[model samples]
Target chain A: MTLVKVYVNYKKSILNPEAQAIHSALNRLGYSNISDVKLGKYFEITVDDDSKDIDSEINEICDKLLANVNMESYRYEIVEGANA
Target chain B: MTLVKVYVNYKKSILNPEAQAIHSALNRLGYSNISDVKLGKYFEITVDDDSKDIDSEINEICDKLLANVNMESYRYEIVEGANA
Candidate 1:
């Protein structure tokens, strides 16, 4: 099986409220030096060994259901010989 | 600033229905080689430079909020001189 790891984050042009809230909370908790506290999602997908073109196949899956193309940007890396 | 990345995954002892559903979907979509598709959460936290003991501080935060020790296993990495 191929392990495909996807990292999804808000587009650079968009402002994320959850990230802002975390930033504020960090400051309040005495982390004044922290900045750009962006929050994002991560997915670890295990693709079948039978896949012919694993790279493109994973990309297609990400575009279809894993990522919100409108406001979010995503990237993935494939690791060979992984179970999950 | 320090960038802390926490990867949370379900314990091996538990059964993850979401992962199973994804596995089934992949098979239906013709990915019969796939197996052991596990689902998990990821967190990227930006901590202030003012932190004295970054390692311990990040661990404290993860134990308190980022990870639920009951059913999830988590690991983190600390990157120095990063914003997020």
Candidate 2:
């Protein structure tokens, strides 16, 4: 099987209130050295070894489901032997 | 500045309904080649370069605020030159 690690995050132009809240909370907790905090979703997908055109398939999946293309962007890496 | 990438995920024994839902949705979408799916949180924290003991500080931050240690586990990597 192939283990695909996908990271979906907001675009730079978008304002992420949750991330801002986390940053404020961190500062309140005394982590003043932290300059910024950004939050996103991560996915570990296990695909059958027989998949042809895996890259295209992954892109399609990300566009169709994993990420909000209008406000978010995504990137993925394929790990050949990692456990799902 | 240092960019810390933190990945927080449920422990293997924990039930992840969101992941299950995504998996089932994929199957319904005719992507049967996908065997499994796991979902998690990803954080990008940018910290000032002046901080000493970054590793310890990061661990403390994760334990205190970023993760629910009882149900989730987290790992982080320090990327030296990545833009926050």
Q: Which candidate is the best by TM-score?
A: 2
Q: State in Å the error of residue B67, model 1.
A: 1.2
- The stretch of ten residues in a row with the least summed lDDT in candidate 1 chain A is A30-39
lDDT tens readout by residue for model 2, A1-84: 999999999999999999999999999999899999999999999999889899999999999999999999999999997765
Query: lDDT for each of the candidates?
Result: 0.76, 0.96
For model 1, the docking class works out as medium
Clashing pairs in 1: A34-B48, A48-B33, A48-B34
Model 2 residue A39 lDDT score? 96
Best by DockQ: 2
Per-residue lDDT of candidate 2, residues B54-78 (tens digit): 9999999999999999999999999
